[model samples]
Target chain A: MVDWLTMTIQMASLAMAGWCLVSTFRDQPMLVPHLVGMGLLWLLVIGQGVVSAVALIGGEGPEETVMYVSYLATVVLLPPACAVWGFMERSRWGPAVIAFACLVLPVLMVRLEQLWNPVV
Target chain B: MSDTTAPGRALRTGPGRLLVAVYSVFALAATARGTYQLATRFDEAPAAYLLSVFAGAVYLVAAVGLARAGRASRRVALVSCAVEAVGVVTVGAVGLLAPSLFPDDTVWSGFGAGYGYIPLVLPFLGLWWILTVHRKDRARAV
Candidate 1:
């Protein structure tokens, strides 16, 4: 895994999560800008997926190929899925949903790192 | 079904939507893990894997129940959440008392320490949300 890319994604998601939380606190619904931010985050996740897939194809993947692939699929899907769900929810909690999903990303990244380098 | 949900007051609306989103994510995670484990090596740890599958199903049902607006859905959500609370407590206790009983870690192992204890707390939160937020028509039923 590319440490810099993973760190960048984690940082971006955290930043977006902070913004979404602020909106939620202020009783604001998710807006267009939030969707755009989600789109950017989704793109980053997709990039990670592609990189990981290529790495796996090159035989430089984790021992648990299925687990890694499954996590990758989920990582790529979450942003868009949560974004659409948030869009349908026209309330302050809409952004809260995104914020929660963003928080989950760091955990998933950590899990990905662990799966890549299992402890002996 | 009990009654038509009030406008903007359905369990699927507002903050309830957020709860449902979280539940759905857990559902997906648990289901994926359970399916993978069960398919790959169910014989190695049948009990733990079966528990994992059960937890996944509970989460799925809870998410669906909470996201649908109806009396039946509300009942479904209530029952699922109750079951979840009981299951987590029982599994956590069993895992703690007899760690050897489970050859592998289930989602409820160590009271969901792997998932940051969210699994332990989620059911209580669900129950609280249902009791308080959807308390309108269910008062008599309760």
Candidate 2:
């Protein structure tokens, strides 16, 4: 189910972010593994975005189409943007960028869920 | 310039860069949200949406000011940070006390409660960083 995949991606993203934060505080470079983890997360987000878009178009009737689309756009772009910015810094800040991005992932996921099933 | 060359000049080269990075992200998010809201649903919450636009502008200006690190940029950043702090506190209070007034949420609603209160904390951090960096420059001058 899409819900399961989304939850998995969210947890994985958070774990990666936590790892990045620890590494940043410890003053370490973001190794290849870190980058790869982020890449996979982004791929998952992209897949989610496509699924959500299709569902919306197919009359699933997202609670707020505008908000849902905005969330989708933000989630899809987040990882690549962070990757570019992180690579540029080349210091402890690089891992810090990853940390921040990782932290935001869960928040975005929560928002996405809310948009899908708004109570009010 | 020599002051920057001085050994005591604080390196803007560490976590400081990460601060800028986060600020930049907020800047982009706020701007996009404001623009989208204004374009699509202006009638729904004009005041809140406009405030979102203003918050975005302040974030953008502050981020640029911090990144430049020149004398003028520092002054701009200080002013922007002050404005942001005032705006967040005021909007947060208003949103909490007069929830009906905001038909929809803005970035400062309940002191950025939706965003983990980062908006409330970010301005303080920005001002602190600016002052810290300036103090280091002054010390290096002597």
Candidate 3:
């Protein structure tokens, strides 16, 4: 796992989470810009996933390869899934859902990092 | 099976939407962990893994119940939520009292201390949402 990319993803995910939280508190629904932000974040996550996949293919993966791959799949799927869930609801709570998903993303990323470089 | 949802007040709307989303996450997390543990290390801790799988199933049922807007589904949600509330308290207390009993950590172990205690609090919120919706639904009828 590239430290820089991991850090970037965590920062961006937290930022997205904070913004969505602000929108929720302000009684604003999920908007186009929020989706676009999620789109960008999703792209970043996908890029990280692709890198990890390539490394795994090269036999440089972690010991628990299956678990690591599953976590990656979940991380990759989360953004778009939550985006659609938020989009379907036309209420302030829509942003709340996104906020929750965004928060979870960073945690999952942290877990992924741990799995990638387990402590000996 | 019968629909009891109010106009613009479906089960998975407003705050309920957030609840469903959270429940879904829990459902996925718990089941994945539970099943994985069951598959690889069930012999190491059968009781704990079984309980983990059960907890995951309950979360799944609760999520589906909350997401679907129907009279029967509401009842299903209410029951599952109640079950969760009871399960967490019972398992958490037992785990606290008899630390060695589990031999491994389940979702409700230590009152979901591993998952930031969200498992402990989730059921009540689910029950509240279900009841609040039920109340509003009843009020509309009367």
Candidate 4:
């Protein structure tokens, strides 16, 4: 995994979380900006997924291959899932959904790192 | 009490919708992890694996029940959340007191420390949403 890409995703996700929290606190609905922001984050995640999948195919896969793949799937799926659900709600808490998903991104990234480099 | 008796508010609206999202994630996580563990090495830790399955089941039931937003669904949600709350606490304590009982980490082991303790808090949040928020929203509607 590219360290800078991972760091950029983490920072971007947290920034989205912060933006969503502001919307939530202000009792505002999830507007187009939030959706766009989340879309950007999702793109980054998908990019990471493509890179990692290519690496794995090239034999740089983690020891816990199954777990890593599942987590990778999770990282790829979450933003879109959250965005669709949030759009369905049309309430302040809609952004809260995005916020929650964003927060989970870093945690998943940390897990990915661990899975990639399991202690011998 | 009245809110519990009131025609049962829609759990897929407002904050309840967000709760549904959270619960759905946990349900997916627990179920996926449990199935993987059981499929790969059930013999290594039957107790923990079984508990993982149980936790996943509870989350799934609760999330679906909440989303359905019916009287029976409300009951299902309540029961599942109650079960989850009790399961997390009891399993957490047992895992701490008798580590041998859990050779592997279940969703509730160490009070869900592995999963950032969201497992420990989720059921309470579920209960609060079911019991209190519905009442408050109903009152506001009146």
Task: Give the best candidate by lDDT.
Answer: 3
Cα lDDT, all candidates: 0.88, 0.80, 0.90, 0.88
- Residue A78 in candidate 4, Cα distance off native in Å: 0.2
> What's each prediction's TM-score?
0.90, 0.83, 0.96, 0.90
Tens digit per residue, CA lDDT, model 3, B32-56: 9989998998799989988888999
Model 4 TM-score (2 dp): 0.90
What's the true lDDT of residue A87 in model 3? 79
Q: Model 4 over residues B1-142: C-alpha lDDT tens digits?
A: 1234335555767888888998989998898888999999989998888888889999999999888856788889999999999999999999879999899998899999988899999999899889875676567678
- Which whole-number lDDT from 0 to 100 does residue B110 have in model 3? 90
Candidate 2: list runs displaced more than 4 Å.
A54-63, B1-12, B95-104
lDDT per residue for candidate 4 within A1-120, as digits (tens), equals: 777889999999999999999999999889998989999999999999999999999999898888999999999999999998987777788999999999989989988988988877
TM-score of chain A of each: 0.97, 0.92, 0.98, 0.97
Docking class of 3: medium
Stretches of candidate 4 off by over 4 Å are: B1-9, B133-142
